[model samples]
Target: MTLPRFRPRGWVAATKAAQRRHQAEAAGGPRGPAPRSQRAALYVHWPYCEKRCSYCNFNKYIPRGVDEAAVRSCLVTEAQTLLRLSGVRRVESVFFGGGTPSLASPHTVAAVLEAVAQATHLPTDAEVTLEANPTSSPGTRLAAFGTAGVNRLSIGLQSLDDAELRLLGRTHSASDALRTLAEARHLFPGRVSVDLMLGLPAQQVGPWLGQLQELLRHCDDHISLYQLSLERGTALFAQVHQGALPAPDPELAAEMYQKGRAVLQEAGFRQYEVSNFARKGALSTHNWNYWQCGQYLGVGPGAHGRFLPQGTRGHTREARIQTLEPDNWMKEVKLFGHGTRKRVPLGELELLEEVLAMGLRTDLGITHQHWEEFEPQLTLWDVFGTSKEVKELLEQGLLLLDHRGLRCSWEGLAVLDSLLLTLLPQLQEAWQQRTRALVPGG
Candidate 1:
């Protein structure tokens, strides 16, 4: 699904506003007491890659002669600045996402972690994850990353079939992926996770299941199975549009998804969220924080963040986006101590939309306690209980609302987009009514 684009005011205006607010709060102005200390997650984006994948549309580039030291220093500075600005006193988790963060030097990783430690309380046992490609990560490199305090490795082994790998425009061969998985397992043990893509063009159900089963034998406790999506402007999308390659089949894709879920369940892997499966004690803490709508800070180029700034009332979250281009981001950090491009406070409707969108994807769903913590002034029933659409969904066995709070049935998860479409309008109307009732002259 395509997200709505937001055109924020210029950075200079936003920066000046933020400074004024911070200064007012510091001087004990009308904003009241300082925001209570909070724990948040951290995401560091590595914007460089060795080769661009055909199906990728992330903010990454195959650069020409990058100064690694300079980039490392910029990342460190941004992390410190943002943490201070947000008044987040503790970090719950850290993720190094990328254009293959494995390409970054171990010293760079250590430096970023050290900066985080100095800025906030970084627990020794906090989950630190790094994304790696098989072509770039070897045994020695994996060992070095482990020594640098990365407790988990998310290896992008998209496929075990050489032809499929080539079609996906991945640089690593099947052998290379297997070798890297072995080496990573040796170093990180049960903390390793593998990402596999299914639903390739003309991919049959039998071969897909076979591939999944084969990987299960060698994979560690965690695996993420994703369906191939041909995003616009991607090479694969262009090929399919030009008739150079076949488009993926939606019907076949649905069949594969169901069968794949069954296969993973039989193998003792729990489908904690759509596209993610893990054994007991191997769930991704960093991603779980995201699905729970917990606050997290993003510090690298083109990274996005959501958190409550100091002195905000209630749980309203502010959205942050860093500069997209690497060099430009570094320059901005040097000038302002951060590379922030936009910092917009989310509205009530926007917050509700994000909460439902992310929370409903998980098995735990949106719990009553979580909802109250997020918005103490309103109860879950006030927002959703009176809707006829919700009643119909409950009657149709598509949704459940026991004491555990609202969640989708297995059948509902397969058609989550449609279900959300049915539910969001009701939520918006309810929220609007609440807003009107709270106003003095409504």
Candidate 2:
């Protein structure tokens, strides 16, 4: 498969902006949204890797002849700047996601952890995680990261078959991945999760299951299975563009999702989210905070965050995502202290659309009561003809009306796009009404 070879300029800017924000907060300015009743988690995106994965499109790059000490210092300053600007004292979870967190020096990891620990209101039981590529740092990176204060580790073992790995354009072979997983079991004292990808260019059902079976033999309680998506602008994407790499059929991908879920469920791993599975109480709090619409702060290059309103405005929320590149990021950090923040504007209708989009994907559906937050907006939508669409879906059993609110059934999940179209108009009307009534101007 051909890869995306063009340098991403937007990502570079975003990375710089994000780095600038972190730097600012570290220098004694307020960072993310203010802390309130609802606590927040922190996601530090370490945007450097040994090599860019062919299928990946995230903002990351291979480090060159750069000063490790300077970059490391910037990371510390950025973290501190965010703490001051946003006034976030406590953090529930701290996730170290990256091109390859394990590739980071152990001292760098320790410093980052220590910096976060000093931040306000960090949870005592904070779930600190680091995403590590199995091959980047040889054999004991997982143990090293664990020793550096990372309690949870996510190993990027995209596939368990050597042929599949090659097809996916991954660097580590299946055997190397297994050895890394074995090492992780002995090194990390907390829970460990393995990432697996299905729906490759030539993936088959039998071999995919074989991979899952093999992974189940060694995984530490949590596993996330993702369908291979050919996002635009990646190397794999270019290969598809040139007709060199084949795409996964949507129907086949759906079938694979079902199979993976069944196997993991049988292995005692429950599907907590669409792509996540875990044992009892093992679901990732950091990720669950997202599904539940909880708050968080994003740091480093290309990280995303959500901050909800506090006190009287507690029901409302806001969100932001950092810039994408790493070099631009370090420069910005040196200049402004933290990356720039792009606040995502949200409205009542958009919120419902978003809530439904994320909430429906999980096993636990959103409750009807939460809809009341936008209840003031839903009047005219009630008068519209589209109201019948909801009734029609209810009559057809495509959705359920239990105490957990409206949720798509297993069959309905397949036709969610169609369903959303029918509900969008009502949602839009409701949003306008709510804004007019509740917002100051209306």
Candidate 3:
């Protein structure tokens, strides 16, 4: 099922005006004290790749060669500028995500790390992660990257099947990926994670299980398993649309997910979040911050960051989205001294929806303490009880409410998009009414 796009949906200016009043009320009224700033995570996007994959949808560029020094310098400048803008001094983690961060020189990665260290008090025990493809480089270069201060490696080992690798347009074979995985494991030990794609056309459960078994033998502690999505404008999507390639079957995909979850569980991996499994104490800290709605700074072309922008009285939630095109982003950063193309302040209602949406994606789910940070006056019952659909879901045991707060049952997770669709409209209506009530003249 498709996820709901969390944007405005025909809500008139009245809604916007009401939301503004709601924010005011939240700041000084019964909503209690404003949330204290937390240590923000840092994201450095490396947008270049040697070759674009067929099924990929992220903002990435396949260029001949990038200006390593220029890009490195820009990343530092952008990160420092964001830190200053957000007044966020503490950094808990640094992640180098990308088209393929491995394409950049180790010196470039080191320079970025050094810049982060200089700009903020990056803890000595902070989790530093880098994304790399199997064919990024030889084991020596990967070892060099490890030496360059990257403690965690998120390798793009899309599949263990050579034929599947070809179909996915990946540059590396199964052998290459395995070799890199071994080398990375040797260097980083239990700090490496691998990404696995499921639900490919013509995929069989038996073979898929075999693939997982093979991966578990070499992987450190984490594995991100996701169903293949046919995103629009991607080569694979176009091919499926034109009937050149068959689209993934939903039934087959569900079967794959269930089996994979069971397999991972048996292998001593815990499902920390949907599509992500980890051993005890091995969760991805940077991503956990995202799920918990903690602040983060994204510095690079097409990157996105969310944080609390300082206000006269308190802090307000704001999002920063950078330019998509690499050259355009560089030009903007040069002209404006930063690459942010859009800045949006989320209203209380928007924040509530976001907190719920993202929080429910994890097994731990959202608690009262979590909700009160953004909307102290609000309660889970206030949001979920307004809808008959949610009430029905609760009665049917699809949703659970306990001392730990609201969370989806295993069944609810299976049809999460459907559940979200049922609740979102009701949530919007309730929030709209609440906002209007907060308005001065309402």
TM per candidate comes to 0.90, 0.81, 0.88
Instruction: Identify the leading candidate in terms of lDDT.
Output: 1
Which parts of model 1 have CA positions greater than 4 angstroms off? 1-37, 312-315
Candidate 2, 347-439: lDDT as tens digits: 545566777677766666556665544444353224232467677887887766565576677566546667777766666665566567897
lDDT of 2 at 427: 67
Candidate number that wins on TM-score, 1 or 3:
1
Relative to the true structure, how large is the alpha-carbon lDDT of every model?
A: 0.84, 0.69, 0.80
Candidate 2: misplaced stretches above 4 Å? 1-38, 137-139, 308-318, 369-386, 413-418, 433-442
State model 1's lDDT: 0.84
Candidate 3 residue-wise lDDT, 1-442, digit = tens: 1111112221232233334433443554332222347469999999988788999999998876577667877887788778887777678888999988887766666666666666655665678899988887578777667666678999999899999999889999999999999998899888888999999977888898889999988888999998998899888899889998788888988888888888888988878788799996788999999989888888999999998765423336788899889888888777776799998887767777888888888888889788888787767778775567788988998788667778888777767777788776776887777878999987
* Model 3: lDDT of residue 119: 60
Question: Of the candidates shown, which would achieve the greatest TM-score relative to the real structure?
Answer: 1
| Candidates, ranked, lDDT | 1, 3, 2
Model 2 worst lDDT run, 10 consecutive residues: 1-10
Q: What digit string (tens of lDDT, one per residue) describes model 1 on residues 1-442?
A: 1111111222233234334433433454232222334779999999888788999999998876678779989999999998998898778889999877888877677778877876676766789999999988888777767767788999999898999999999999989998999999999888999998988887888888888898998999899989998899999999999999898998998898899888888999988888899996799999999998888999899999998888788558799999999999999999999999998988867887888889999877899988777677777787778778898999999888878888988788778889999878877888889889999997
What ranges in model 3 sit over 4 Å off? 1-38, 312-315, 385-387, 439-442
lDDT of 1 at 400: 88
TM-score of 1: 0.90
Query: What is the Å distance of residue 5 in model 1 from its true position?
Result: 37
Global fold similarity of model 2 (TM-score) = 0.81
